[model samples]
Target: MSFRESVATATVSRSVHFFPLHLRRDLVRQAAEDLDRYHGKAAADYWRSTCRGLAADLTAKGCSDDEMREQIMDFQAAVQVALLEMHREQLAQG
Candidate 1:
């Protein structure tokens, strides 16, 4: 069963195994832009909601932790790619 890699990956390293953090630069950038007009939890809330929605989508599509373990570059891999993109962008600017 091939799981669709809809969202990009972000590697939030806490172990040798990569976490599936579905964070895309465009999505995060849009979230930042949308949240820029707000402050505090309002901004945080947007990100929280976005992540939740993405998680839900994965679940709805039957993307379980077990399935993640099976795929080569599945949603789990996407998580790392997403974060790496963000970190790269930050580095480029600095």
Candidate 2:
């Protein structure tokens, strides 16, 4: 399956029942933003590692892979927005 598909599936299966939908989305978005901030290939590796860790944790708690992915996506999105805001602030300061 494609990466997005896998993530979506994992999210649905693992996390949907635990968190409210909006919170889950926010968590995944934050994770994505953090992953994007790293230098070079490290960013990709960080995201992969983070996702794997999250998946494992969720599974241990009886969550499905789909839920884990969803949470990560939410975190990523939140991070992205925060990063953008920080950049803007920095620009304003300069």
Candidate 3:
């Protein structure tokens, strides 16, 4: 099934909601770092796509537009912070 289709059917997937809050946050950060490593210059585009997907999912789950926007902003900030920390570590190691 397509991502949108799946999200539309389930309020939250087990893969996501199964985890504790802290673990889920760590997973998000780790995913951002991994995507940056894999996508390099295209990582920003990928991240934006991820946030868009989040918005879609939130909408599917009946979130208000304002709630979706706030969540997306928070998600983007977390990803940016993760990427920045990884970059700083790489620089420090050089």
Candidate 4:
């Protein structure tokens, strides 16, 4: 299903929520660092901790858990798409 279609079908996904501009700018940097640091062979616990940290950060920033879940889900989708594109580019270059 298209991103729009899926989001439209889900009640909580009705809108794209962005962080405050400066915080938004930091998000990609944070995600990259967290993913790079936490992702690896046998790194399940590491990744889980990273996700927990992210949720904590959201909570500290005053996002409700439901709101955090919705936004994080959307963020994950975007990150997956970005990773796919990077992989495709690497394969093409190779």
Best by TM-score: 3
Per residue, candidate 4 scores C-alpha lDDT tens digits across 3-94 of 98787789665555547322453564455445645556535675466567777887787687798877666665555555566567779999
lDDT tens string, model 3, 1-94? 9999998778564432212212357757876776777666587677667778877877787676776787777666776677788889989999
Residue 56 in candidate 2, Cα distance off native in Å: 1.8
Q: Superpose all Cα atoms of candidate 2 onto the true structure and report the RMSD in Å to 1 decimal.
A: 11.6
The TM-score of predicted model 3 comes to 0.60
**Can you tell me which runs of candidate 4 are displaced by over 4 Å?**
1-26, 29-43
Query: What would the TM-score be for candidate 4 when compared with the true structure?
Result: 0.56
Once model 1 is optimally superposed onto the true structure by TM-score, how far is the C-alpha of residue 9 displaced, in angstroms?
A: 30
lDDT of 3: 0.68
Of 1 and 4, the candidate ranking higher by lDDT: 4
RMSD of each: 13.3, 11.6, 10.0, 12.2
Q: Is candidate 3 or candidate 4 better by TM-score?
A: 3
TM-score-better candidate, 2 vs 4: 4
- Estimate candidate 1's RMSD in Å: 13.3
- Total clashing pairs for each candidate: 9, 37, 0, 0
- Model 1, range 1-94, lDDT digits (tens) per residue? 2334322223332224333433444554554455545679886786567656766665566666554444323433454455566668879999
**Error at 82, model 1, angstroms:** 10
Where model 1 places Cα greater than 4 Å from the true spot, the runs are 1-25, 66-94
> Using alpha carbons, what is the TM-score of model 1?
0.39
- What candidate 3 gets wrong by more than 4 Å, as runs, is 1-23, 38-41
